[model samples]
Target: MHLYGCPMTRSTRVAWVLEEAGLDYHYTVIDLKSGEGFKPPFINLNPSGKVPALVDGDLILTESAAIGIYIADKVPAAGLIPAVGTSERALHDQWCFFASSELEQPLWLMAKHTFAFPPDQRCPAVLPSAEWEFKRQLKVLAQGLGDKTFILGEQFTVADVLLSHILTWATRGLKMDLGDEKLEAYRQRTQARPALAKAREREAHEAALKAQAQ
Candidate 1:
C-alpha cells in the first residue's frame, strides 16, 4: 500500500491511522507548494489534487475521513472504529461526519483566507468570522468530550483520529482559547500516543526530504 501526501498536513491523521493499524506502506510525498500536487498522474488520482490519497493494491481512496474509516476496517484489532451494525457504529459515523462537515469546513475557509490564496486575492476580514464558525462547532465537540479521554468515552476510535488533526491545527491557526478542559486534555492524551509520535517523526523526515530538494 502507498499513501500520497505531504508532511504535517491533515494527511497526518491518515498516517496516524495507518501506523496504529500496524500497516507497512510507502509514503509518496506531494509537494503542494511547488505545484507538484497539480501535476501529472497525481491529478488523475484525485481531481482536487488533494493529499493523503491511499493506494491499497487495486483499491484507491481519498478524503481524510474516508481513509480513517478504511484503515479502521483494515485493522480491526486497532479498535479505531466501532464494528459495523451497532449503535456505536452509528455514533461513530455521526462523529466522523460532524468532524468533517461541521468542524473542518470552517477551518478550510479560514485557511484559504489566511494563507492559501495570494495575499492580494485573499480576504483579510474572513478570518474572524471563519474562526468564529470554527469555535462554535468546536463547542459541541468539547461538550461531547467532557471528562472523557476520547470521543467515544475511554476508547480512541476513528473519530478521534479524524478530528484531532483538525483541533490541533485550529490551535495553531487561530490560537483560539481552548476553553474546554476535558477536550483539551483529551487532545493532549491522544497526541501523546506512540503512533502519533511516530507519525510526527516520519513527517519531519519527509519535510527534510522536500527541503533538501529545494
Candidate 2:
C-alpha cells in the first residue's frame, strides 16, 4: 500500500487511521505548496489534485474520510468501525457526514477567507458569519458527544478518527474556543491516543521532507 500525503493536510486523518489499524504503508511526501500536487503524476493519482490519495494494488482511493473508512474496513481486527450492516454502522456514517458536512464546512469557509485564498480573492466580511456558523454547529456536535467515551460509546471507531480531527482543526487551525468542558476533554483524550501519536511522528517526518524539498 502507498499513501501520497502532505504535512498538515487531510492526509493526516488517513495516516491516523492507518496507525490505528497497524497497517504498514509507504508514505510519499507530496509537496502541496510547491505546486507538485498539480503536476502530472500526482494529478494522475487524484484528478482533484488533493493530498491523502491511497493506492493499494489496482485500487486508488481519494478523499480523506473515504480513505479512513476503507482502512478501517480493511482491518476489521482493529475494530475501528462497526460491521457494515449494523445500525451502529449507520450511526458511524451519520457522524462522519455530520463532521464533514456540518462541522468542517464552516472551517473551510473560514480558511478560504482567512488565509487560504490570495489576498485579493479573500472576503474578510465572510469571517464573522463563518465563525457564528461554526459555533452553532459545534454546539450540535457537543450535544451528540454527551457523556460518551467515544462517538459510538466505548469503542474508538473511524467516526472518532474523522470527527476528532475536525475538532482539532477548528480549535487549532481556526483558533476557535471549544466552550464545553466535555468537548475539550474529549479532544484531549482522543489526541493522546498512541495511534494518533504514531501518526504525528509520521507527519513530522513528512514535514522534514517538505522542508528539504524547499
Candidate with maximal TM-score: 2
Worst 10 residues of 1 by lDDT: 172-181
* Candidate that scores best on lDDT: 2
Off by over 4 Å in 2: 209-214
Clashing pairs in 2: none
Give lDDT tens digits, candidate 1, residues 117-214. Answer: 88898998887888788888878998777777688887888899877887887786657666777667777788889999888788788778878987
Which segments of candidate 1 are over 4 A away from where they belong?
210-214
TM-score quality measure for candidate 2: 0.96
Q: What's the residue-level lDDT of 99 in candidate 2?
A: 85
lDDT for each of the candidates? 0.85, 0.89
Evaluated at residue 200, the lDDT of candidate 1 is: 78
- The sequence of per-residue lDDT tens digits that candidate 2 reaches over residues 93-154 is 99999988988888899898888789999998998998899889889988888999998899
